[model samples]
Target: MQSLDERCLRYLAEAVGCGSVRAAADKLNVNASAVSRQIVQMEGQLATPLIERHRRGVRATPAGSLLLDYYRRQASDREDILAKLTELKGLRRGHIDVVLGEGFVGDLMSGLLQGFWARHPDLTMTLDLAATNDVVRRVVEDEAHLGLVYNPPPEPRLRTHLAMPHPIRLLVRADHPLAAHPGPVRLADLAGHRLGTMHPAYGIRQIIAAAERAEGVRLDPVLITGSIGVLKQFVASGIGVTLLPAFCAAQEISAGSLVALPLADPGLDGVEAQIVTRLGRQLSPAAGTLLQHLARGMAGEARSGTRRSSSSR
Candidate 1:
């Protein structure tokens, strides 16, 4: 068999990734015909159809799937090699991609990123906010070097580096009726009040849904949003209560604007803040260092009790 063309392989990978040859062409800034021709050449060389078209977009055939996996692994290995070479030259420069849930943003920005950047000044980082499931997907697909998620579901492909219990809490304005409840807030306590919540994709919402089922109660959120910022604002403005880990509203709680009340349900209390990476993948030096820093920060939050102010609430 003839050696496959590297350009053809790249075009094939992009086409599958984008789910259409034209979309891949737009991404690569090339004519659709050029991408199509490259894919055709690859098919001819392999003597098999690589992709199948459907209503949504194109999908890889069995053979194409194998090739795609091979390409991705090769690309990842190349990046690892290049990173190691750069480290050998004493250049502390490499890009680290991190995908995480929005709840982690406060802690990451306030405690981790600045210090990491100071130590490795030449390194660059990309922080992409996503839901729990999306964070897991990005790490499993090798799109990100690290993931910070809250109560993510079990996945064999994910390796958890650090996990700290950060229970879900009912967030309300300081002057709200439940603010001085003096005990764990029950779902029954939320009755007859406006409820704001995250979308179903969020891990926080997933835990909330489980608690609702276990306790035989249904919560109809008056407002549903994907952004943690919006949820904070909703509760801060006294619009309604929302479920979130205390750390997400740390600044607000500290500012005396919002209060984090522990939920009565044990299921909600089981939620954890976790740092994860793809299992078996070798991380770049910068990523490894950043991972350690993140773990330390998360551990500190747990030890110091990010929800310590709830007692005063």
Candidate 2:
């Protein structure tokens, strides 16, 4: 059996990335001849050329490609072993990576992340804000450890960990006349009212569009934006109202800056905020704990939203 060490793997990977043995040596702070010698030794032992020298630099031969894949997998396995070791000893060294919709990353997540980190100071967390489609795609591709998105379509490569009802709500300034209503708001009530909302591609916008079509009303928003922050600001200006997920605007509603009202229509009941991950991946202990905590909060918030949506004026 031909035994390959980590040093050769590192040098080869760097050489491939840099496209030249000399450049790889410069980056690794070693002599170019030394890197060439290592490659030659490996080729002699394995009975194949690892690199093909060319005018533009060098390219990996078929055998070298196989070795590179092995090296990549070996690194991944090592990380997994370290994660397990961390769990067995204590939850001190493991980390988590989460990708979620941009709309889900406001004041609510800020507080939750801070509180979680305060308790587990040694564990690391990464937040990647993306569109819902991109969030699901990235999770399916194993680019992220977990995902939080609303109204995601089914994907075979993804597994749903938790799903909670999260119906859309009307966001209006507290001083707006519509804020006087005690019950859920209806589309007809919004006739002639200027509105601000996200663009057509967003899930919330799709829900709003479907509702508008059913009510036989036309709501050409005065402001069409792709930014949740921009929509919130526009609604707060008292010139228009925007519909959003109740949890997304929880802070503004509580602060009396805006009011939340649910739609009375039954056609929009399937909307949900879901937690997802790659179908076959195992989460690290730190990631698992973080996922569970986020899931619990989502469930509680969803239930509260349901109650609010059903309230009467």
Candidate 3:
């Protein structure tokens, strides 16, 4: 067999990623026939079929999966090499892709991004907001360099760089009745109150569900949404109380518009926010530095929360 063509390899990777040659062509701004031709050439070079089509879309054959994996690693390694060369020139220039849950956006912007960007002005970063599962998938697939998730499930392919306790709290307007609860609020106490919650895709919702099961209760939220902003607005408008980490509503709580109360449920009390990367993957220098900054910032946030809790006591 002849040496494989890089362009053909890229076409194959994109086709598999998009699940169709037409979709890949649309993404790459090329003709579908051109993309298909490249993939066919690649298959001929390898002497094996690269993709199998079904009703839903296309999937890689076992051999195709191996080739795709090799393509991803090669792409990542090339980036690493370029980053190292930039570092050798004393230039802080490289792009870092981060996939994270929407809940982390406020803290990331307020606590980390600006300062990091100021110090490494030549560097570029992309932040993509996704659900917990998508965040993990992107990191594991080499599509992103880092992930910030809340209470993510255990995955062997990921490494946790930092995990900070940011347990679920009952969020309500200051004048709401639950705000005056003397201690941790129990699930039973939430009875007869209006409830708003995120859609099940969110980590907070999953934690809330588990807690409800453990305590043998069910919460039927009047409002269910995929947006954290929507949930915050729902509470602020006095529509109902919602469950979230204290830091998620830090600004509102500090401004006295919303109050975050502890939950009595053990499962909710143990939730954490984590920063993760692909296990065994070497990070670019810029990405590594930003990770350190994020870890420190997150630690500081946790410390601040501790101080606030102590002072309240």
Q: Tell me each candidate's TM-score.
A: 0.93, 0.70, 0.93
Q: What's model 3's TM-score? A: 0.93
Candidate 3: Cα lDDT at 64: 87
- lDDT minimum window of 10 residues, candidate 3: 84-93
Please provide, for model 1 over 102-129, each residue's C-alpha lDDT reduced to its tens digit, 9 standing for 90 to 100. 9888887885788877778898889999
lDDT tens digits by residue: candidate 2, 82-191: 78879986787777878887667873465667777777889987888777778887776555789988777778878898988777888899999998986777888887
187: Cα error in model 1, Å: 1.7
53-136 per-residue lDDT for model 3 (tens digits):
888778899988988888888888888788888888655578899999988988987848988887888989899999888889
Q: lDDT (0-100) at residue 204 of candidate 3?
A: 84
User: lDDT of candidate 2 vs native?
Assistant: 0.80
